[model samples]
Target: MLTKRIVPCLDVNDGRVVKGIQFVELRDAGDPVELAKVYDEQGADELVFLDISASHEGRKTMVEVVQHVAAELAIPFTVGGGINSVEDMKAILRAGADKVSLNTAAVLRPELVREGADYFGSQCIVVAIDAKYDEETNGWKVYTHGGRKLKDLDAVEWAKEVEALGAGEILLTSMDSDGEKKGFNLALTKAVSEAVTIPVIASGGAGNAVHFKDVFTEGKADAALAASIFHYKETSVEEVKSYLRKEEVHVR
Candidate 1:
């Protein structure tokens, strides 16, 4: 059985790690390079570094930052934010990212998903979606540029489309649960996980080990990602893995 992954996310802005609620009201956490090294040594299955303001700021990802963080870790690393073209993806990959995650760029041009999969293979392409419930539509709506822009895209349908386009994985983040430290949006996670054949990573709203287990066993996610919880020493990756082992969920 494949072990469920526990990943620590570093949300970067202006060269510093930050956290926010529902993708707003940012709070500085620490340095990305230092945090990445700590998470790597703490037994994190993977590390995700997202330049939260890159797209909104109209700049490519922070290559120097990515390089600094990558140099500190031995585990697989994934980078996202402002990845609009194959060249951008290539740059990050060359900088030591095992995978490149696409958000605003992928939604803006769905063809990029297919093109990325063709160029780097599906396993290297991850589609990151930030979604929130729309009271007017009574369905989940996709948000872009770090949940700053609300798009007309339907979250559920977009998941299927990206999978069909050869995306290897889906990093589904719940805008409603993000930074709340309540729990994962299991309903949304399960919906997307069930709808796709590829692996789905549940992000946002992980308060404890239970939330991690819920995402893996109940939400059926292949991985669970958290920022504040891990960043603030609220929970450790090893503890979560130990708890999952007791729960009989395969974990590394």
Candidate 2:
């Protein structure tokens, strides 16, 4: 069986790790390099470093910060935010990110997805979809610019398109559940997971270990990511893995 992964996300803004509710009202978590080392020591399967304000600020990802964090981590690392082109991906990769995630840029120019996959192989490219539940359309709508802009795109359809365009994985974040700490959006996660062949990393609303079990089993996410819970010591990676193991959910 493939073991489910537990990833701790570092939402960086102004060089400090931060977390917020529904993508606003940010609170400082800690230093990214320090947090990465802690997570690595705690046996986190992987770590995600997102310069949350890069895209909105119209700048590239913090290559130096990424390098610093990557240097401290022994496990796989994924970097996102303001990664706009193949050149951007190359720079981050050269700086030591195992993968580069694209959000607003991918929405604006999807050709970058194919171009990135071609240049660095699909495994190095991750397309992040920030989605909000739209009651009027009765579907999930894709958002970009850190959930500030809504695109006329369906989340599931976009997931399929990204996979076809050579994206190796999808990082699906539910804008509705973000920082709510209730649980993940199981319906949204399952829909996107079933719609695409590649792996799906479910983000948002993970408050406890049971939530990870639910996403891995019912939500069908290959991995579950959380920020505040882990950052604040509300839960530990080992505790989560132990809980999942007891629940008969395969985990690493």
- Work out the TM-score per prediction: 0.89, 0.91
Which lDDT value does model 1 have at 233? 73
Q: Which 10 consecutive residues of model 1 have the lowest summed lDDT?
A: 20-29
Look at candidate 2 and tell me the lDDT of residue 40. Answer: 75
lDDT of 2 by residue, 1-252 (tens): 889999998878766676632222223235677667677777799989887664534234377777787777679989898888788888889988899999999999999999999999999999999999999989999998889998999999999999999999999999999989999999999999999999999999999999999999999999999988987788888899999999999877
1-252: candidate 1 lDDT, tens digit per residue = 789999888877766777632222123236677677677777899988887664544244367677777787778988888788999888888887899999989998999999999999999999999999888977789999789999998898999999999899999999999989889999899988998899999999999999999999889999999888876677788788889899999987
Q: lDDT for each of the candidates?
A: 0.85, 0.88
Clashing pairs in 1: none
> For model 2, what is the alpha-carbon lDDT of residue 74?
76
Model 1 TM-score on a 0 to 1 scale: 0.89
Leading candidate by TM-score: 2
RMSD of each: 4.2, 3.9
